[model samples]
Target: MHKYVRMAGFFGLSEPPPIPQSLRNPRGFRPFHFAPDDRIICFYLDFWHVANGDHILHPHALMFTHSSTLSNYAKYLSVVPDGQSRRIPWEAWGPSNARWMEGNFDSSYYSYVHGSRFAYKLPSSYDDTGETQIIRMFDFNPYAVRHSAKVVPAENGEEGTDADGLRAYEEDMTSGITHRDVTSPSVVSAGSFFVDDVHSSLPYREVARAVQYAEDFSILIDEANIILLTEDHTMRVHTM
Candidate 1:
């Protein structure tokens, strides 16, 4: 039951789109597979992509191990129950996962969620000043996932090689990469693998102040209304 389970890294969020960016059009992560016992999960949200040089804004939001509020409410819980699926196979998706997405979130990419190692979730050695503000969850339980090789097939020999070396030298290279970035394959994830900060247990009735410094957001509780999707792509509706 512990033959493998090593995934730790973090720091994501900031792909809400701007400068002609829309809503999650090939953004990232969105998986699910839960049958009589086939368990699996995934989710995505980037808060509107920007970055260090673009100024600043690399928000974060993800999912995977959700065994239904472990207690203390589990940061108000992020729902996702009821069968799930979404195809998968394109060689698992690049060099398998290019050694866990170029490696490093300390060793991963700020995400992991395979829970149920007997309801895994421990850390009560002392701190519990009445839940102080709960905001820390990291679980593990992977069966098999060790990937490598993330994308190779370009040998121009110079001028950029093959992720698009100046358009393969200039106009019509035969390789692609959206615009740039790719071709650093020395691979590592040998396979593949793949939270934080809180406060707010229902109070804010509305908020979308033109996103001055909004970090991350996502909501959709129905029975009436309450659909917020902040980080500046705007969308606020509260009626419930």
Candidate 2:
């Protein structure tokens, strides 16, 4: 056996989530994992624009590698139908996962699951491989996107040294971004995350539509970080 295989045998996980039978061939989606927090968010659609009578609904989905972390990485786990887990070589959601999909779908019109899911990673060691920590995933629903940083703190020494006169005017003043940009964060890459409307009251298609466009949203962690995603027949991520 290879050296890495031997190491995995010593400290490897037991099992991961499995793909649902109906969503197997199509690969419905992967559960989202929020970093610094253990919350998973899942997204899926019940109906499509086609008029085939509900058979056109494709479910299976997964995230792609945008960050350097999963540039050439593999899967780690999979979710089963019965809530059981299994281990896989691919790195869908590993130990670094943080946030995930939750209840956000409703049975309505003008709304549907646009993309797959959004996810993040926490600071973790990749099996003591001495590899640098990083975040990476696949873009689920590709589209146009943009992002902007709401400055909380300015760089050092640039605040305010002296006023018009030759006197110390340290009152914490700097050129603020007074104008709002019309552009939003560009969706660079979609995170390899997926969610199911496992807890919905209406049909799958109805729930998918409502959740896809619903504006009511809650971010996982609120730190000195900013992420923006958009849709234009593709997915993109803005890292600022």
Off by over 4 Å in 2: 1-86, 89-92, 95-98, 107-150, 153-240
Q: How many clashes (backbone N, Cα, C below 3 Å) per candidate? A: 22, 76
- The digit string of per-residue lDDT tens for model 1 on 9-99 reads 3432211212223553555633532221222233332233223545332223333322222222444334534465344432433232211
Task: Provide the global lDDT of candidate 2 against the true structure.
Answer: 0.25
The lDDT for every candidate, in the order shown, is 0.27, 0.25
* TM-scores of the models, in the order given: 0.19, 0.18
Q: Model 2 over residues 75-121: C-alpha lDDT tens digits?
A: 43323546666554323433222112222222222121212233233
RMSD of each: 20.4, 21.4
Model 1 lowest lDDT segment of ten: 200-209
Say what the RMSD of model 2 is. 21.4
